[model samples]
Target: MSKRCFLIEASNQEATEGQIMTVVQSSASHPLYGDIVTIVGKNRVNDNPVIISAYSKDSCHLEAERPGIVVMPNSVEEVQKIVRLCSSTKTPIMPAGGRNGICGACLPRVTNAVMLDMINMNGIVNLDEDVMTITVEAGMRWAELIHRLDDKGYKLGFRGPYGGNAATVAGSVSINSMGYAASRFGPAPEGVVSLEVVLPNGEIVRTGSGWNPEAQIFTRYSSFADLTGIFLGDHGTLGVKTKVTFKIYPKAEFSTYIDLGYKNLKDATAAFLEIQKRGLTEELNCLLARESADTYFPGLLDSHPEINATIHCVIMETDKQLAERKVQIIRDIGLDLKGKDLGNFAAQIHWAEKFNEVQPMYNNGFWLNTCHLRPISRIPELMDRMRAIFKKYSLEKNGIKWIADALAVDRAYAAAWVTIFAPTKDKMELAEKAWNEMLDAAMETGGCPYWSGLLWEKRALEKVNDTFIQLYRTIKKSIDP
Candidate 1:
């Protein structure tokens, strides 16, 4: 089959004057191109420059090795066939979904890799109301899944990531994303009950209760070892998840949004931890600095000059009284911590535009996001250190902005997105230097990143325990090697 090959001249960081780049090659030249096209059809496979360039980078600032070809498989059988062919040919295969990851997790690490664009495989497989579970194809976007469940008066524990509008169910769970309702439901992986993964050898395996031929996907910790955990947050290293089953909950009828302002980070973080420990929020997030609050809410802090930090709480319950009671308890905690009631404008706006709030902020600058997990109690210390680093980098003088925002996860920890903004291309180098320093500071403060893409892999390897690294390497080699 013949396909259009466009040759373009572009300037890159490594480009010299008058350099030509060949991003795409004719399918006739690729040895495995015909084989992949045969499995998924020509319409579903492309080696065109336009398609390859689009998949070269994700939401992150870094771009890695681009795949030689991209293919969209519509069925599990097609995925298996493609994987088998790649495995036999000793070719690298990378699974990509949604392409909404802030880390470079979806980018191919090798040039010869086959990019399995899983978006086409997106489909709802089952919704077992009796079992209170929803099974969907791995490529299904979270926003669509949530909307479908909403129509049925049901919802997921952790609804989805902040990028839910474009983030896929498997994509968020694969990276253990914490967002939306994570204050009570924890990260995305906690809600997953089962997974249908295609291993590197092209063999299909079912995890959780699905292992039992007679049982449905009801629970994650059933039968032998918790195999489901192996692939959760594996960054698609262990296998390609083709299907996902998530535990569903009846839609909560009542919800209350509250925003509390504290004079200092210590008070704000204390109140946040108290509310989380009491399990009083469906969604909870905090801006631990006045700068962060200003960045997020703009001029709201002008009225409350005494407030240096702000906490936004979203409480949901089956009963209105229960939700109110939880809100009252949170209010009392905030009051005791010397927090001022800021009303629910911030919280309401955030909830109303959950999937959109963060994206639009990109207009402000290029974000060097240092997203990681850290203890709630240590947030004050972390902020102090972060401020020091920012000051050292003269970020404000350089016209670079920053925000330290945290989402309360589970009950005790927080998923912090310490973002550094580079408003112009000229400031990227300084922003990167500040970002790397902040990353080291976060690690020193006992923070752990959920996803180690091209951004955090090197730092994580350097800081991770030797024994843990060996064990992980052994597991990876055994599974994919």
Candidate 2:
């Protein structure tokens, strides 16, 4: 069986450049006849994968390392045909969005599969200012969406962290992404007003219609069943998302970022819990010593080597003088827990410059890696337990320290993270061990890991009751079987 790849470019709703050269096939082609096709478009690939080749670099996030066959489906019908062919042939069809996933969830694991690249289907269908929602093809990048929305003084919920330099809105939502602004607007799944999916059997379906004012609340299939929810976090294992409609919010007038330090995790978390209760701040992120600080702010390590605990940060947006008061509140609360007030600043220019710098190391040739755990309230007690496990593991000796940060989802919830500095090759193993231990710890506290980290190993999978895999299987069977 010969596999082929094509570089497709769509223009005027038709396959133009590279796609025209490759022969479309239903099954594996002859070695001499097979061609490997890659689809290239603006905002279609990620920057990291681009380093390998100009083809990977130029395309947005949809890089396929051993891409068998790259087919760019320019219209809904084209996508449907591709899905149908794959389903009938039992070929593993991988849908390419922006390929920014750290866990390789978007890429097809099965060999001799077809890659249905969706970067070409990006057409703006509607922008209802009154309704405060926009419908666009699934291939539109968040950066493009942000630019389009900024013209109307609107912004979508937090762009997912997998939201690469050029990740698309559809790809982010397909994986149920959570972004930097999660504290304010929640995850990308929260912003989805509707979805247009091409099922495995080549059926076209719409999740919700913003135009329908009488749309049923949260129902996807029957009035009692939610088909959309089943596929929301399915990680593209269900079907290819062709279009998405999500809500947007007005841009904030003022935004400030304050960085603070605590004596230890206990003191910092105590303050974080209380500040969350007050509900004055817009977004707060607590980066444990290993995660946020090491990835984004490495310079701090050189200056304060002994500061091996945790750093707390917040982005508060408001025109009121409440900025200073909010700082005071955080300080006071931390003080009660015997935490030290590191410093505070209210500089708009500075904060704006640093606003989208979550993984600053990406610009400097380092892979900006991250994973989401469960929400905070359910994980704090578990985090304490994990800390004990870390102590027993003694990571510092291996030059591997677990840096973590968390955001308060509500008064009773917090989502904590752990960042490990190790070789990429060893990361999978370490993450496997850490995740299993973490999952066990979290389960003890009745918390589950985030939706994005659904690709982890058996131990972690067991913690979530194989929900991710089961969801994928159910959707695939329904759509394909």
Candidate 3:
């Protein structure tokens, strides 16, 4: 096969040497390329093969049908115009953010779709300290938003996902991402004050307090039916989120990190649930099994091979005394559960290198991630079932690796991130089979995934109540169709 090399742009930023991928062909002209260029200027649009392949898949192992063209819209007006044009031409349009999603959420389902690269639209629209709210263009990255807020002595309740370096505010919000301070503030949508969305029919709609033209965009529960929720976690099926208003908080003055080691998963899970219930941490994550701990921390457990699981907690407060009190309470709960103080290395490293840490794990193998939410008390049952599945598939014997981990979210549930590593291309098929089985097992155990995208969409839909699915479809069709 004839091969061509192209430097893939990193989230609409500069191309890096590591991003150079070998694909076929060069730029191919599209029928609507001229129209798109006219809307967003020629420089912001591309019919190039490199851009096509770059947008063909997210961080998932699967690729979608290649898009015919990619358009970068820098403003709400430009997005509206492009959507109007696509609607009039009956062309499928897919709005994409940083493309950092692990699932196939941003990929176009059809070959002739127009991929909207929203990166160019990144800009902070407003920062209102009076109301403790920040209004920003949907394309703004979480890391940028956090730093900007930090400089202003404010922070978001739920900061962002672990991939905040490349994950966009709107992208994470749209998928209902749970990370950072999720243990305290719930998911990203919980912090949303309002949203400005461009509907499928090329009409603009503002939700929450923005529903009233005269009201300030300060609350999500106000005005009529709380329509802002219609778009949250919709995975871009309803509309394109152009602007988002988030509730911000004053930056905490004190913070602490703690790590606890347990001899078994049950004790670790018990301590994790207690910490979350007592609201002692801003962030809480636990490795449910020895393999998972080894996967994340490597030889850290070498000296303590008896420890089968570990918990990391991050506490932040405006008062030093309060923070210290919370830290002590967390330690007490862990100790009561027969846990050992493992120091703060894991928690500190996780906090300091949030975005950079996850990528290095790819060096182990490609991930078949079955990430979802479940009750914290069920971690032991789920872990046992997962082990059974791994044994059934002879995963370890075949040289494949897996991790069973959970992150505390809200008050009662944990986001279970069960992952299988396909060490090589030859193991991918087997890994996929095992992954599907695991997903089924998770669903049977009352696990609910936040992001569907292409990864969990089919499986999730299958498990969803028919009435709920119909209601969602009804709303989706009423707005889009």
C-alpha lDDT score of every prediction, in listed order = 0.86, 0.56, 0.84
Tell me which of candidates 2 and 3 scores higher on TM-score.
Answer: 3
Stretches of candidate 2 off by over 4 Å are 1-67, 210-225, 290-295, 298-339, 345-370, 375-395, 423-447, 452-454, 464-476
Residue-by-residue lDDT tens digits, candidate 2, 1-481: 1121111223226544323222222233412112222323322222221221322322222234444455566777667766766676677777767666555556555555566667777767666555566677877777777766778677776645534456777777776665555666666777777777888888877775422455422223443355567668777777888878777677665544555566555556666667667765556666555344555555544554444444354645445466667666666676776655545431222234332554443432223233555544443465577677666666555445455667655443555555444434454455446545754665566654454432443445555556776976676676667
Best by TM-score: 1
lDDT by residue for model 3 (1-481), tens: 1122111122223222212212443354787877776775556677777778777888878787888888777678878999999888989888888998998888888878988877766777777766778888888999998988799789899989878889998899899898888899999899998999999888999998887776667688863887998899888888999989999899998989899999989889888998899877888999988888887887878888799999999999999999888888899889988999988888888878877877787887998988899999998888888999999999999888888778899898988988888999999998889988998988888888889888888888777798998999899889877
Query: What's the candidate order when arranged by decreasing lDDT?
Result: 1, 3, 2
Per-prediction TM-score to the true structure, in the order listed: 0.93, 0.73, 0.93
User: lDDT of candidate 2?
Assistant: 0.56
Error of 1 at 369 (Å): 0.7
Worst 10 residues of 2 by lDDT: 1-10
Backbone clashes under 3 angstroms, per model: 0, 31, 0
